[model samples]
Target: MFLRRAVYYWQLIAALLLPLWLFVGWGIWGGGAWTFVGVVVAAPVLFIAILVVTLIIYGRSEVRAANAVSWLDVALLALWHLSIIGLGCFGATGSLFAMLTVVTGLAAFWGTLWQLVRGFTRRARQTLREFEQLAGQTPPRGHVSSPEQGDVYVVYESRDQRRA
Candidate 1:
C-alpha cells in the first residue's frame, strides 16, 4: 500500500520535474554554455505554466484522487525520461540510437497528452449526463403546471421501465 501510494505521487512529481531535469541535464552534458543558461532560465517558466494548466484542469481534489496515476503513466514517464537522458549521453550526435531516443520521447509525450485529453472528454461527458438528468427532473419555471384530474400518467413502472 505504501509503495503504491509512493509510486502514485511520484508520477505527478515526475510529470512536473522530468522536463526540467532532461533539459538541464542535456545542456550540461552537451557542454554548451548558452544551452545550459537557456534551459536554466526556461525551466521555471515552463514549470509554472504547466503547474497552472494542471491546477486549472484537474483541480485539487481530482489531482489528489487515489490511484489517479496508473502503471501506464509510470511506464511512459520512464520511457521518455530515460530516452532523454540517453539522448544527452549520446551528445546530440546524429545516429540511429539518437533517432530512436527522439522517437521514444515523442511517443511518450503524445501518449501522455492523448490520455489527458481522453480523460477530460470522459469527465465532460459524465458531467453533461448528470446535468441532463437534473434538468429532466425539474420543469421550466414559467411553464410549470400541476397534474390535472384528466391527465394520463403511468400508474406503475418496472425497474427497467419495459412493459411485460
Candidate 2:
C-alpha cells in the first residue's frame, strides 16, 4: 500500500517538478544570462541538498519509519518554488510568466500541504500505538458478574414452626 501510493504521487510530483524546472529554465533563458546561471546552479544544488537530507533520514531505520520534520522544512521547500515563481513574475516582464508563477506556486503549496498533513497523521498514529503499548494490561476489575460468586436464592421459613 505504501509503495502503491508512493508511485501514484511520484507521477504527480514528476509532473509538477518537470514543468517547474522548465519554467525556471524558460525564465532564465528569457530574463538574462545571470538568471540562467542562477537557475542552472541553484536548481541542482537545491536538489542535491534535498536528496542528501532524504538519504540521511531514510538511511536510518528508526528515523525512517517515524519521520518528523519541522514546518520550516516544509516552508523552505515551498519557498524554493515560490522564489522561482517570484523570479518569473517580477523578471519576466510579461503576464504569461506571472500567471505561470502563480499557478505553479499554488500547486506546489497544495502538494506540500498534502504531504505535511499525511506526515502528521502518520506520526499521530505511531504515537498512539506507542502510548497503547506503554499503557500495559487492562484493569482486573469489571462490571460483569462472575458465575462463581454463588447463586441468588430466597430463603423462606415457616413463621408458625417452633425453633428447630
Candidate 3:
C-alpha cells in the first residue's frame, strides 16, 4: 500500500524529471550525435507518454479514491520508469532497454485502459442490479401518493369593475 501510493505520486514527478534526465544523461554519458537527435524527440514523447498513462490510471474511480494504484500498475510502471532511465544512460545495452521501455509503456497504457473499461462496466452492472432489487420492492402499506395538481389562478377586480 505504501509503495503503491508512492509510485502513484512518483509517476507525476517522473513525467517532468525523466525528460530532463534524458537530456542531462545524453550530455554526461556522451551518446552518439544521432542519439542526441533521438533524445530530442524522445524527451517530449516520454513526457507525453508518461502523462497519458498516468491520467489513464487516474481515470479509474477506485484508484482516485484510494489514492493508490494496483500491484499490476506498480509492476508495469516501475519497469517502464527503469527502462526509460536505462535508455537515458546510453550504455551498451541502451537499445535493449529502449525496446523494453516501449513494450512496457504500451503494456501500461493498454493495461490501464482495460482496467478503466472493466471498472466502468462492473460498476454499471452493480448499479443495474441494485435498481432491479429496488424494482422488486413494494411501497409501504399505508403510504399514498397525491394525484397531480393543475395550475391555480386568483383574480382581483379594479375599482371600476366594482362600481359597475
Report the C-alpha lDDT of model 2 over 1-164, residue by residue, as the tens digit.
44333432343353346346645556555656665565566455545544443443334333344444334434444454455445544344545554554455455445545555666788789999998987764333333435696544445556765664
lDDT at 150, model 1: 48
Off by over 4 Å in 3: 138-164
Model 3 Cα lDDT, one tens digit per residue, 5-55: 998789899999999999999999997889999999889999999999999
When 1 and 2 are scored with TM-score, the better candidate is: 1
TM-score, structure 1 vs. true: 0.50
lDDT of 2: 0.50
TM-score per prediction, in order, is: 0.50, 0.33, 0.83
lDDT of each: 0.56, 0.50, 0.90
RMSD of each: 11.2, 15.2, 8.4
- In the predicted model 1, the residue pairs found to clash are none
Q: Who is ahead in lDDT, 1 or 2? A: 1
Residue 98 in model 1: lDDT: 46
Question: What local lDDT score does residue 161 receive in model 2, on the 0 to 100 scale?
Answer: 54
